[model samples]
Target chain A: DAGITQSPRYKITETGRQVTLMCHQTWSHSYMFWYRQDLGHGLRLIYYSAAADITDKGEVPDGYVVSRSKTENFPLTLESATRSQTSVYFCASSKGVPETGTRGYEQYFGPGTRLTVT
Target chain B: AQSVSQHNHHVILSEAASLELGCNYSYGGTVNLFWYVQYPGQHLQLLLKYFSGDPLVKGIKGFEAEFIKSKFSFNLRKPSVQWSDTAEYFCAVNPYGGSQGNLIFGKGTKLSVKP
Candidate 1:
């Protein structure tokens, strides 16, 4: 309730269909991240946002789009889902401190969104 | 690009057994390292982190890790592990002089502590 949360914990969608995974954090952290957890790959970052309206690509941002219209919400959109996109998606938030630099914060993660692209 | 490597993919041990998970990174200069634990059907939680100052960092749940600059390693250790400690452990790194939000995570080590 007080931490980060992801909507639609489990999703089943067909190929070529659009789906959005919502992430909300009550902490109002400045930084938010979206990652996909796959077997043998661990957790790979797809996108990250520094603040509202500021987003950047991560290691595997292909076929994935993210928007941060508000500080508390960072939603990831898949215009057309594919089989490769079927994985456990995770949303995390971090509160950055100015003195310690941005990397100084610890990330808190949500339960996760298990998406099955059939 | 910075990257993290976890040597063990799966490890099995009994209760009260000593545990050590190896983690290495391929980044030069200063770095911020972290160890995160993900229990079964749960989100990832921070175990310990190494930023600056001391190389030996102690974290939650009787866990500790040592950051060796010379070896470019940050290995997690626990003197005595319990069945509850069975989970996936990930090592991540954020190399300095770049975007702080960019964190390179390891493949992760799955620990199975038998009771």
Candidate 2:
């Protein structure tokens, strides 16, 4: 009730079909992020939004698109899904990287959306 | 580009045994270090973090990590581990701000505790 939640926890879609993963946070954090977790690669950032409309690309953003229309929600879309896009995707949020001189900022993570492409 | 490194890919330990997982980073200037844990089928949770003042930081569930600036290492440790302590741990780093907060994560270490 107090943390971030992701929708379509498990999804099965066909290749070339469009899909969207939803993330919503109750914290109303200024920053929201999307990451995909694969077997060998721990977690790779997809896209992140600093605020409502300021979104930036992250590593491995080739086949994904993101839009942040509101502060609480950041949704990631697969315009035309591919077999390679099947992975467990996670969403995260944090205030900032611990002021400026700090070595830490803790981020809250969502349960993650596991997508399977057929 | 900044990158995080986790040397131990998998570890198995008996109950009541001590535990340590290795983590390293390749970044110049300052550093922000973190250790995150993911129990089977659960989301990643923060174990602890090291900011500035102290190198040794304690986290929930009886875990601690020491940040060594010289070797670029932040290793997680537990004096005595329980069976429930089995999980996948990840080390992450973000070099600085003004840059998009892209977290560089290691390959991860999987710890299996035999009860």
lDDT of 1: 0.91
User: What is candidate 2's TM-score against the reference?
Assistant: 0.96
Expressed as tens digits, the lDDT of each residue in B8-113 for candidate 2 is 9999999999999999899876877889999999999989987778899999999999999999999999999999999999999867664677678998999999
Locate the minimum summed-lDDT window of 10 residues in model 2 chain B.
Answer: B94-103
lDDT of 1 at B30: 78
TM-score of each: 0.95, 0.96
Q: How much lDDT does each candidate structure score?
A: 0.91, 0.90
| Model 1, residue pairs in steric clash | none
Model 1 stretches astray by more than 4 angstroms:
A97-103
User: Tens digit of lDDT per residue, candidate 2, span A1-118?
Assistant: 7699999999999999999999999988888899999998999999988899999999899999999989999999999999999999999998765446554567889999999999
The lDDT leader among the candidates is 1
On the 0 to 100 scale, the lDDT of residue B27 in model 2 is 84
TM-score of chain A of 1: 0.94
Writing each residue's lDDT as its tens digit, candidate 1 over A1-118 gives 6789999999999999999999999999999999999999999999999999999998889999999999999999999999999999999988862233544667889999999999
